[model samples]
Target chain A: MLIRRPPDLLPSEITPEPLARGRRALLKGLGAGAALAGLGLPQISQAGSLGTLRPSPLSSDEKLTPLKSVTGYNNFYEFGTDKEDPARHAPGRLKTQPWTVTVEGEIKRPRTFSIDDLLKLAPLEERIYRMRCVEGWSMVIPWVGFPLAELIRQVEPNGQARFVEFVTLADPQQMPGVRSPLLDWPYVEGLRLDEAQHPLTLLAVGLYGEVLPAQNGAPIRLVVPWKYGFKSAKSIVRIRFVREQPRSTWMKAGPSEYGFYSNVNPAVDHPRWSQATERRIGEFIKRKTLPFNGYADQVAGLYSGMDLRRFF
Target chain B: MTFQPTPRQLTAIKAALFLLTLLPALHYAHGLWSDSLGANPIEALTRGMGIWTLNFLFLTLCVSPLRKLSGWHWLLRLRRMLGLTAFAYGCLHLLTYLWLDQFWDVDAIARDIWKRPFITVGATAFLLMLPLALTSSHAAIRSLGGKRWQSLHRAVYAVAILGVVHYLWLVKRVALLDPIIYALVLAILLGWRVVERIRLNGPWPTRSTPPAVQPVVFMKRDAAAALGVPKKR
Candidate 1:
């Protein structure tokens, strides 16, 4: 199962790591200039154009998965169930233009922000996060977005807002898979108010220095680094601040298999499969899955004194 | 419309069918070598092999119904080859899981077989195919006698059912359409056989007496003669 690495170019021809980093910095500066220039103009097409992203120190130094695999392989059932279905069907089928995300319910200032307005809410940062799927596969993706906390601050949720629920777009005309009754439609995911405000939890607008592809939940999506990939709802249209714990789509579909709190703990085996180890996409050997997907130091406190197995 | 081929032509057809069955294996090998099996090549290979095994099983089951409906007796001559191809793919699927997935970890493999319902069902299906594969030979068939051999090979129905259930249980509940289609095809194939049986013998098997007519037995002899094989005299 080992794939041979392509023959390396001559050492003299290769750019050093620091120089490459400097070049990326230069590019970011130029991108910022371009972004400012395009501010007055109408919104750019969703395929490309994410403007500028301020690089974050929080990004993982581990090798990023190839953009091909990141964009190609997806589990957005709104497109279809097959891994490749999203990539194949989502591009043309999904219309992200003139999109507006309504943030309401248990919030003081209920606002419906256009995609453009949402992008400008906070400074976007590049966070290289380890995304682990429940189906024994993992990927390290350089996601470009701002923290979810930024939006929460803007809306100012009331004390009754104990939980946050994310609802994604489900249009049958746009999403063909919506025609099939696969789980409850308009995929829903929720997080505790504290978990939503965590620095690591992001509302991703793009990846790999480009606008988020339609398959990867174009325009905007939630990115919960410590949880299983499904926790991150895609193509979001509504964000609700609720009091009771919201039941996620997977949780509703299979209560025993998928729990509301799907934190990536290697010890917690899925009812149908083991999660102790995960195949890291391109690599042949399975790597040991870490507690909280190696973000235990940052997120372990959120679940302290709670039985993860029971919650899961 | 029926046409009988010469023994040489039949051999050529059999050879062609054998090569056709190898295409799926070759496609996967090419996918592996070219590094085009998406993100997880091992999973792609494993699942592909398992699917082909089910496909061949479906083909094997279709033979009798096809021969009966179309009056093409020679189709039965290809059934054993189809069954064996299904078995071959089943073996490869198991090997992929053992070597690539489990890394030959006996402890993990044993635990999986014992704990996971899908894995247990899949393993049982493969194990049951072993006896049918062993007794597929002409000599083994002669030693066991036609009635006993047929009864033993009837285990294929069970194997097919288990294989479908294994697949259904393996996938996420949302992705049940593919496995359900396999289940439907199997049901129709088995249902055809049941209807044929009812037509041959009354709906109820009253122990009063056996039916005077045995067209199925005669058809097998006719198929053997068509394929230029000596009858069981």
Candidate 2:
């Protein structure tokens, strides 16, 4: 109910008014044509409507991971710990429709915006980014969302706001992990202000030309392509700006194994296994992991002169 | 209505267990053939094999104590079969990690075994199992002699313990259910052995057995030791 209306779209926002309206009209025409042309195809998500965001200059041409693989296999520990647990258990278990993200702490405007407000507030973009898990597996995902920088810019972080922290929902009725003490509940994740503002940083709302699957962090999730997948917190409910570095779940759980930055570095191995190579989804042999996950040219300067292994 | 199975029946029982032990491997093979491993098949394959290795180790440990309590001497025969199957699974587990997961990256694997505690413990357990697996032969048993061979095989308890530690430490966030369940089962199995030992030896002090009673206890101890060492010749 709260995620369908864009009543708060300000005139000064990023997307120009005329262009936005024009695109909507084009999408409508395409949807109508699609329905009329074939077996009256009902699904028109791929009609460059719900998913077509701005084309990211930073994305790759690599083959996109299949939607089924992307949605069916996940590590949203809230549903359960297993990769398939979310797919099997999360369909009707969690409520995503009336989701709201509370933006607060050291910001000029600290307001709670419903999912609809988020969609209207920021212009979406499609980015085919590499997602590498800390457990040595990789996938190429086509994400649809606006830049996290735009969201941070809208909130207007004060100078004291140094780190951006995100918190996920912790409801036992929906999340089984909340009942189990496997992790400190209300899973928290963070990034430095600079990293949060990076152009590649995304606040994803959809994937594969469709709305985000409940299993894959529906409604809202953060996506930092350069870092391990865990750093990109899913099912985000709150974004708080703070002066000090925020406490992240994995880093809090095992500091030695999971560092705050969590940058994808083959040189620095996890405590239990090597991170030098990653098994891509559907591929048998592992491929060599890249520096900054192959976006070194863009992101390396952000950590200039800092020791990655030490920070990691 | 006797629990004793004839030699032919014993052979049939061993055959059934051997097939049962292959089920995990066969299931993994089917998964591989059908492309059902989902996303990272290698990770699935490696993890599955490693878990089965731990399972077989626990199953092998379970046999002795269960046999002791059940009063089924025939269960003793399945011990070697179970132990060897554990070793086979262990070998496959290591090979999967080495050949498929690491892609024969010997240097990296060497560094991993040396540096990582989980890998180190796992490698140690596998190495300990290796000597027992190698010596599982009629000629080796005959040459090593009963007392020495029995002493050598006693290393199995340590192997099972180390195997559990390796698995427990491997998980990132301590997947409690599997590890805790495994620990409980292992604790019970090993507890049985400990209780049986104290029952025969009496509490710590050696408690000065009466001169006449000592001979009878020594006879029981000798027979038990002999029972542990399988005859080869």
Candidate 3:
């Protein structure tokens, strides 16, 4: 079977060399002002906004999944379960503008904020992270947002707060799948307060430099790097700081299958599927799944004494 | 009287059905060529094979029920072909999981089959299909003789039930739509058979042939009750 590989757009956005991985500040063609100012519109018109990200040390040396494949193949149950369903249903149906996130509960400044207002609340930066889905496929995504910790700090949690719950939008008019009880409708996810405040936990607003495509969770979404992709709730509408663990949608949907922590542990496989290895998008072969999605070095301390297998 | 195709026509129809069985693989090939298998082609491929395997299983199970329902006894001629196609798809699904998925990690494969309930049932269903496929030939059928061949093939109903259970448990949350449909089908197919037995006599396979149709030698006397006809010794 003779097939032609597309010419590499290398020495461009994605560099192969590990040393040049995080040199995204120099590579970003759009100024920060342009990206910030264009947040009001559904589309970001800036040329480089959808191009090479301003990489950081957190970016991986591994290959980057194509933006087309990344956005096209998604598992947003709000749209549908098929990988192509979200790409087909979300773009035209989802209304991203006029979106507001309610940041209430256990916070001193409990108030609703728009996409632009969230920008004002915190600065945006690019961090490339490997997103491993519990389905056993992984992708390295260049995400644009600030640390979720920054927003948590800004909100100022009360001392009694021990967990943070994130709720996704449940509008059947836009998200057709919300009409079905495939999952508990208002898809909820949560993190331990410390996990929410971790430097790696990002409140992503954009991806590949542009504002997030609706299917990719436009406006704002949680991007917890260490957990399975579902734990990184999308199109987040509310953030609740509570004293105890909240009922996360997946955990509630299948308690034994999807645990509360849902961390990326290669050793503990899902009852139906294995977690030992994952097929990276665009590649034929799978690589060994890293513990904590390769951030175990930084995040392992959070679960020091607890048994992951039982919790998982 | 029921309209029946001639032997020549039946052979042609069987050939067509054989080609129809390969349509799913052809559709997958087109998807692979056009790059439409989404971000995860292997996942799509694995899933496609698995779905098709079950699909053929249901089609095979439906043969007897449909024959009984519609009085289309000719449908039985295609049962072996349908069953074999299902077995072939099951092999592909397993091979894809082992080679493309586990990359021949024998230990992981063993652990998966042992640990995963869904995989255990699915593997059992697949393993059961192997003997049925091997004995599908006329030579094996003759060597085993009619009664034992019929007895061995009777296990297909059990295999079909296990296949549905495998699919039902394989999903993350046991989403009922698809699995329930499969279960309902297996239920109806199996239901008709039990009801059929009571109508024939008691729950035992007796040596009986109705005096009403002594010359109806090719009517599969044992299966006649399931064929919606009463037979007596």
Candidate 4:
């Protein structure tokens, strides 16, 4: 698969050759180690590194957020509610290898694909996308994954499949926060069929050219660049195609604050806080939040005539 | 068991408490210097100061209940200092938001105070604390007269309630455990005062003069006089 770098990206902005080569070597070592440790065993292993990543034209040319910040700060409520809780607790708790994603409901071909199968389905492209949180913060993340459309096409949704729902793992033994009644367990998120099939929508397995850390939804996760970060569900174990709009976890938690569309529109303020501006993760001063998180040219047509304030 | 701290012991205790209260500020400062306050140091600093402000407010409210329960009049000697410390931290919290977070952008600050409910409640709570802090000095208390001063200072309860509400309103509903805990603590403190009021008098207000207010004792009588706190009648 031939991949083209983003036109705006400078040669200097690409990952250094030595670092990329070293990471590739580390990934090879990890694969060997996993094989030696009894390939037949079902026990999950730790995430190490992802091999060579092809730069995609879809990538944002903006400066990448620091890997430390991306890995350290997270909103994975299954681990805990605090931003730092996921990093503190998920490493030792979550088991990621031998993972399988069950694709079912309203699809022509429903099948459970193991993590290895999913990784080999398509070439992993490094797409740097701007991620905006509903809580007035944002990050630029280089996610390594293929378009969700690739997997969707493989499954071939039936006529009845109007929406797709993503469900995350919620084992109490693995996720301590699952014990707390924060939201209904087995966190669920959904997207309209077209939105899910968007070329920008990704099924990310790694970030920053490395296999995702446990805190960052190891094995696989969704990355919907146009929506608020929560709309991109993490540590997904199931994807179900549905006939009707599925109620997401956040919608159930706060219906007024978190709407189904959840497209990043600065005009639609959250009931509690303004969506006008966002503090970029590392920056001190807040910057004006863009409509559709600056993907207006690509996604504005999706919500052309709808009232975002009402939908939001 | 009955225990009463001596005058010298009271001064030492006050001195120790003063130093202890500064620790949270120092910790945030050191975190900033070392670049260890996670991804957003500005947020950590702003939030750390705000939480410490609430802590001091809780500590200030604890004095009355602790004094009444233990029959230790000396605890009142520390109340003014504790209240003042809460005000100090409140100032730092607001400054951090205005300077670091907002970068002294008057339009943005105004927009936040006007548009955001959490900011509205937080700013109102700080505004209400100002008069109480100003009247905290013995001279101002004397000028306002004890009876009127006490009534005015009672606004602290409102400030405490607003502060907790501000916290509750700002956080996402899923992460409300911390704010709810603060609300519960304030409820118990205020409830204790309510139960004490009914026990002392009756449930209803009476035409007759209520019992004498608690004596405003100080660490040293001469020092108290210098500070304008009247001697116990």
Model-by-model DockQ, in order: 0.59, 0.50, 0.48, 0.59
lDDT order of candidates, best first? 1, 4, 2, 3
What is the descending DockQ order? 4, 1, 2, 3
The local lDDT score (0 to 100) that residue A91 gets in candidate 2 is 75
Instruction: Tell me the spans in candidate 4 whose CA falls farther than 4 Å from its real position.
Output: A1-12, A15-46, B205-233
Lowest lDDT 10-residue stretch of candidate 4 chain A: A36-45
Q: Model 4, range A1-312, lDDT digits (tens) per residue?
A: 112455676786665566456444654567643453234222224444455467877788676677778989899999988899999999978888678999999999999999888888887778999999988899999898889999999999999999999999999999999998979989999999999999999999888766778898987899999899999999999999999999999999989889999999898888887788889998877999999999999988887798888887
Comparison by DockQ, 1 against 4, better one? 4
* Tens-digit lDDT string for candidate 3 (B1-233): 78699999998999899899999999998999998887788889998999899889888888887898799999998999999999999999999989998899999899999998988988877776776787789987888777767756765765677788888887655246778888887777766766775666654445364321221222233233223321221
Docking outcome class, model 2: medium
| Residue A57 displacement (Å), model 2 | 1.8
| Model 1: residue B6 alpha-carbon error in angstroms | 0.7
Predicted candidate 4 versus true structure: per-residue lDDT over B1-233, tens digit per residue? 55788889888999999999889989988998999999988888888888888989999999999998899878899988888888999999999999987789899789889988899999988987887787788888788789767766777777788899899998887798999999999888887887886787875346275432221211122222333433232
- Classify candidate 4 by CAPRI docking class: medium
What is the C-alpha lDDT profile of model 1 across A147-214, one tens digit per residue? 99999999999989999999999999999888888689989999999999999999998877667889
Candidate 1 per-residue C-alpha lDDT over B131-181 given as tens digits, one digit per residue, 9 for 90 to 100: 788778999899878876775676787788889999999999779999999
Count: clashes, candidate 3: 3
Compose the digit string of candidate 3's lDDT tens values, residues A121-140.
65566777999999898998
Summarize candidate 2's per-residue lDDT along B107-204 as a digit string, tens digits: 98999899889899898888778778888787787888866786667677777777888888888663667877887887887777767767877763
